[model samples]
Target chain A: MKILQVEGLTKVYGKGDAQVKALDNVSFSVEKGEFIAVVGASGSGKSTLMHLIGGVDRPTTGKVQVDGKDIFTMNESNLAIFRRRNIGLIYQFYNLIPTLTAEENISLPYLLDRRRPNPEKLLEILGLLALTDRRTHLPGQLSGGQQQRVSIGRALINDPAVILADEPTGNLDSRKSRSIMELFKMFNRQYNQTLLIITHDEKIALQADRILTLEDGRILRDEAVRA
Target chain B: MWLSKRALETLSQNIRRIVDGESVDLLDNREGPLSILRNDIQTLVRMKQEQADALRHDKERLKDSLSDISHQLKTPLTSMMVMADLLETAPPEKHAELVRNLQTGLTRTQWLTDALLKMAKLDADAVAFNVRKADAREIVARALEPLNILLEMKGQDVRTAGEAELTCDVRWTAEALGNVIKNASEHSPAGKPILIACGENPIAAWISVTDSGEGLKPGQIARLFRRFQGDGTAGYGIGLPLAQTILRGQNGDIEVDGSGLPPHVAELTDEEYSGATFTLKLYR
Candidate 1:
């Protein structure tokens, strides 16, 4: 099933001559459980593309269909729910609630759904993330790597249809980076989870099942790896 | 009687010195039964001091653990209460969002509680491993089964070679291999093949899962198996470590060689990119 579809996606910042087309006429579709890596240099609108697809920002012109529903057509409130329930967003800086403990941040999506998190699933996730001990530690108390894990936990907690990560491992060292990639792969395989990651690292990009290279807000290449 | 009084006085002085954290040489100038008494007292004091230190350390650890638990619980509780208050006064349109936020808070608290309980069990070594002889191919098959759907979605294939019979707790070993294979499969690109080669020697049985992805750097290879050692990129640093623990319990070990070419060039190489090769070895 095609879980995410982006068509004619465009986002302009500022106005007139000062207007910046961060993402210019970008169009792509992601299959369910597909692991995609988006790579581009700085100022190529990589983050902008992510934000538009994530519904954190609206596209100036275009359509985004998540699970066949036009996300832009929904009202702001409905979009918020859709984003919470279907889209799991991960960032380089983690963006965790500093005041909340690791476990709280992971379960935020569930809380947003006004439902209880499944205990068994939660335990499995904590075990998978190796966060059993750090569950109680606040983000401030956690190391950079640990905080990112919590953020990833938050993203996975909802079992969203699509996980959109922007430089999810940018701040991590190579070991952490490898582990993080392994984790994304684990979820993609174990649960058939769909992933769209934006990264600048060539090595990281190459791990994806499909590599999408963006240049100046346009897709320069969308190639599959031939074994 | 005079000698006995003198000995009593020395003993009292030595006890005082020990209590004050000062060193005392009780047997330096003594001989006979007095020296023996002095040696016994010194041993007794040393044992008591060690016990006190251990107790103090445990107490400190317990204190930190309790504080962490309370703080973890409090944050969600506080957030939920705030959300509930907002919900009460929130406009009808805002109520749904607030309710969602409120529920998220409760869910976090619940997850934390459950995670803590499981962690406690793992810490207490409450999980028992059932070790027995099993077919290595069967173990690999079981491990790869869950990932079949994902592999098919990615248009990837896992190829297994060689076969060996080994003594292991099939379930736990499979779980460990599953994690390793999952890691390898994720790093490998679509259409790329993940190779699982099994072999046995006089002393051990081994399986190596290799992927054609960007191999790990030297530093990364060093810390790959450490628990909670994520680089803040993707993982919580649990799976591999758990796999390690499981293997270790079964008299087995995991090794990774990430010295292969970069992931991009790995595709061009006939040697499977060497991005990473995780080898699981179990002693016979």
Candidate 2:
């Protein structure tokens, strides 16, 4: 089944004299549980595509359907709720609140939605992230790897329709980066999680099941690593 | 204005570009015979591009293997030379162990060369596989014939379950399966039983080997089949690539399922399999 679809996706920036087409008629559908890596050089519109898909930003002309619901059609508040409930976003910089402990940071999503995370699932996430002992430690007090783990925990706390990460391990050392990738891979396999990672790192991209090469806002190639 | 009714000159130029080995960015609107003609032309260009890519890939692989083969051979050769010097100078009493060391080095070199040569043949399309329907048990038994001593040395165990009669080049299939089994044995803890299961599904007949070690780490599965591209966590060999080639030559392939949690493990855990499971799928 198709989990996400981008149809005639186009994004334009600035106006007439300084205008640039960030994305150009891009269209693709992601199957359920697919782990895809979008790779491209800088200014390839990778971030624009991701932002549009995450529903954080709207395209100038396009349609994004998340699990069959057209996100652009929804109002801003409804879109925010839908995004929080269905889309999980992870960034290169560990986006944890300074005052929030590891546990609190992970629980932020739930707090925002006026919901309570299941205690058992929370415990499982902490334990899985190897942050059981560091649960109360603030992001500032933890190492880069630990901080990233907390972010991962936050992403999974909701069990969203799909997980979208941009340069997720680009901030860590090789060893730490590998451990983070392992966590992502593990979740993908056990739960059949739908994952889309935007990375400039070829090694990281190769780990995915398919690679989509974007150049100048266009999908240059779509290759299956394992079909 | 109909989308497909674009100027005749533009369509001719686009078709001309495809014929001249250039990729034409396809617009998302087309219908009828014009679409079919355009598609076929695009396919031809794609295939041409793919063939060129395949050629470059093969060249890169050749370079990698050349370096790998030399590196592998140099170790034993250098060691043997050192041993030869020690034997000439050392007394006869020490000469015994010296000779034994030299012999070991020779055996390793021989094995490495032999395997590399076989792989080269596979690469060159020199090996003509004899495809036939064969007993799964018989092939499994044959594959294990050479590994018995290694397994016995480590006190390892093998358990066979289920069975399937698959169409394949039995000896080559056995050879390929054996290499995979060998890898599993290396990963598995000593005395742990490696389960071999054979069965046929609607798509293909398969023989799967499940080892008792922690499954592959992140990023390992993708490179597992590449020649000499071992997962950094474990020492792998050219055997996997060879197995892959042999199977592919006969319309078969190898797949690995390294989901950390085993099938029965419902809870969250990072344990990869009981270990990793490798399955050799032979198309029916």
* The candidate that achieves the highest TM-score relative to the unseen native structure: 2
lDDT of 1 by residue, A6-56 (tens): 999988899899988898899999876689999999999898888888888
Tens digit of lDDT per residue, candidate 2, span A1-227?
57799999999999999999999999999976789999999899899999999999999998998766788987777677667667889999988899988998998877874557899999988987888999999899999989999998999887676899999999998657756876776677555678999999876776688889899999999877653
Docking class of 2: incorrect
Residue A44, candidate 2: how far off, in angstroms? Answer: 21
DockQ for every prediction shown: 0.01, 0.04
Interface RMSD of 1: 29.1
DockQ winner: 2
**Where is model 2 chain B poorest over a 10-residue stretch in terms of lDDT?**
B261-270
Off by over 4 Å in 1: B1-284
Whole-model Cα lDDT of every candidate shown, in order:
0.75, 0.79
What TM-score would chain B of candidate 1 score versus the native chain B? 0.59
> What are the models' TM-scores?
0.50, 0.56
lDDT of 1 by residue, B1-284 (tens): 12588877978898898889886644321324454455456546645654575577667755765666677678788888888888888789998888888777777667567545544444446767777777789999999888899889888777777778878878778878987887777777888888877866543577778887777754576576655554566544455766776776666667566655333223333554556778787755
